[model samples]
Target: MSEVEVVVAHRERATLRVGDVFLKIDADPGRTDIEVEAMTLAPVPTPEVLWHRPPVLALAALPGTALGRLGEPSTASPAAWAAAGAAVRTLHDAPLPPWPGQSLDEVAARVDAECEWLVSNGVLPTDLVTRNRQIAEAALRPWTPVFTHGDLQITHIFVDGDEVTGVLDWSEAGRGDAHFDLATLTLGHEERLGDLLAGYRADVDLDVIRGWWSLRSLVVVRWLVTHGFDPFAPGCEVDVLKSRL
Candidate 1:
């Protein structure tokens, strides 16, 4: 029998791997529903669903290794990074998902609330929070919606050699801003942005991407802390924010 490996386990969800199959257990079935549908709709590669039972969704693991993880240097070549970008473009070009995503007001409200919490709780220095909030404003404007992987963390993308093999964790996928996906993918790995844009082949505002980098970092710090994650780790979210100064 294959030994079970704990992939990720938090309060709301957990994933276990047994041989080549992964088992995702979420407290909310709605997230699993979205994940299943999103994988069905995405134009780019996604994990194959082996089976799904309520809170537990089983998947066949993709063949390749993850592109990289936050706070860690990527061993993937420039071509591989570019390939991931091209795959993201393809996903963005796909037809929009039926469900609506978070609106501009909703995002702005969250940013406001999170910033206040950060300052009040002393999670971050007031000056750092203030500067990042100012930067985050650049991303508050309206945008054309596209099929987006809402959480396009490098760990979610898999590449084999110079080719993108598949993407994972579709629970956050929906119709959203294209730059959000781009920003999420390149969050800590700013050096690779040019190579990514080379394959993305689209006009993108660097400032807005930077804005999202700040906004995303500010908003997620509290959650990361509560969930037993280390956002303050070296080259992670805090460092990503500090780089803007």
Candidate 2:
């Protein structure tokens, strides 16, 4: 048997890899419930839920390597990106889940609060925060709610030979803005967006997606720092913010 290995250990949760099985432990059982349901409902491939015992949920490992890692160059082919795009498109078009996601007003308020904190602490230049906030306003308007992966990042998708093998981390899945998924996927790799959008074949508001990118980067910086992670790492969240300036 392979030795158990820790994949992630954050304040809120932890994931351990043991042989071909993954064990996710969280403080809240409701989150695990959502993950299990989302996996079941998603049209795209997802890691199989092996079992669940209270806070610990067991999952079978998926095939293939991650499509790409955050804060690093993507070695995945353009076709893989396209496949991921199509998978996300399929998910967005699927029927809505029972739960509701954050409303646009709630998101806008969070963005505004985060921006104020950033400027007050001198964590970032005032001009940079202001400009991005202006751009972010485009995303705060009403949008038709669709199923979203909430945190659909490059690191969460697995691919092999231009095919999406699986998607992981579905605790945040719910009805929300579709551009949020697009923005989350293309956060730091904006140049590759065309390849993904080409595969999606659905028209989306580019400006709104860009706004989500800025709003997300700004709000997450504080959380990352508090968790002992660096947002300023090369090609990370801070870098994405700087790119918009």
Candidate 3:
């Protein structure tokens, strides 16, 4: 195997190339378990940066790296999306570990920590509390907890043709509301998003999915703040976030 290429790089996490092996280095002490656990939604092989005294994640590198893939939709919709939706749903429905020992408040607090980090990093707007409160009141309701792709989106749905080869970046997976995953796909591009959500709702509720959408927008805004408003990648999503926010 050849050394994997460091295709995507970030301030806190740096992807490495080590013979078809991608290692993610979390160079910051502010990392948390809530973030890294998000990657399990996909069945692909991933390695983590042991963030004790030194934290890092070593991910298995996938074949083929598209330099300009994010600029446009790589796969066509309908069939491609359908396949992707199924792949995610399968993960969402998988038998997950019970949370009998944990409290809901603890889980919510974890999310709050990430949200706070995002805000302080300039990845999220200063009005996070107000925005989150509104979303919580409107969208958070009775939900059968399942595996959520915390950051599911077209960008994260990696594919090899009509087949969803894999879902990338599981740094935010957990037994939470499934709407977050559905909203990540639908909220912005309602027409196309609706189709995707429709595909997802084959297993869950679409009406109560708005909270996830709002939360997804919050995440997108954070991406925009941390990353410059790139017209191609996050730019498209940001535009949708602005309209909805």
Candidate 4:
């Protein structure tokens, strides 16, 4: 058997590399989206219910940022934005049955709980939740719900030239409010968000999506400030998040 070594650890999962295959184990019980590299284009068996979401096996990995190869680094380009947009569109369109465990509210509550811990620990300024709740509630209004990537951000997309090859992470994939997904993207990269929206279905309200961005950014700032920038850590994401706030 090939040995594995931990490459990265997060709140919910740990990445282990064995030979050419990367094993992503969810910290939570009964969650599986493990990906194994396939060499040829062949039809694989339908994934068991244990497989969690259907993994994207063929998308080529891209290079740019250390976190994920998301579009053009720092500077925004049309081709890059379009690539990111197309990637997300593909990810969102992938055929997968509902996740077996964890409800959407549970996930939101998990985020809220993490924020609450930060507040209780005094890492986040007091009144952080109060202010954020108001913002999120206001932003969440005026949008219908759809299946979302849940943690969709520019950094999750892999881009090359004018084409998007893949979306890197899928641990947080679920059915939820699509606006929240758009919001998270817009909040982090406001300048390039318009380009992403352009690739999405035209019926979506950009204003509402922007509002979600504000709320999502607020939560992210609180999390990074309190937790010391673990997600996409060691990079300038913490600095960027702080700049937005």
RMSD of each: 0.6, 1.0, 5.9, 6.5
In order, what lDDT does every prediction score? 0.94, 0.92, 0.54, 0.49
Tens-digit per-residue lDDT, 1-245, candidate 1: 99999999999999999999999999999999999999999999899999999999999999889999999999999999999999999999999999988899999999999999999988889999999999999999999999999999999999999999999999988889999999999999999999899899999999899999999999999999999999999999999888877
Per-model TM-score, in order, reads 0.99, 0.97, 0.64, 0.63
Model 4 spans > 4 angstroms off: 1-7, 17-20, 33-73, 90-96, 100-116, 127-129, 217-245
lDDT, model 1, position 141: 95
Q: Stretches of candidate 2 above 4 Å error? A: none
Better of 1 and 4 by TM-score: 1
- Highest-scoring model, TM-score: 1
How does candidate 2 score on lDDT? 0.92
Model 4 C-alpha lDDT versus the unseen true structure: 0.49
Model 4's TM-score against the true structure: 0.63
- Tens-place lDDT digits, model 2, residues 72-182: 888889999999999999999999999999988899889999999999999999998998898889898999999999999888999988999999999999999999999
Candidate 3, which segments miss by more than 4 Å at Cα? 1-5, 28-54, 63-74, 98-136, 197-204, 219-237
Error of 4 at 234 (Å): 11
Residue 232 alpha-carbon offset, candidate 1, angstroms: 0.8
Tens-place lDDT digits, model 3, residues 99-176: 322235654554466567766776546675446635544454545777665656566665555555556565556666
Find the 10 residues in a row with the least total lDDT in model 4: 38-47
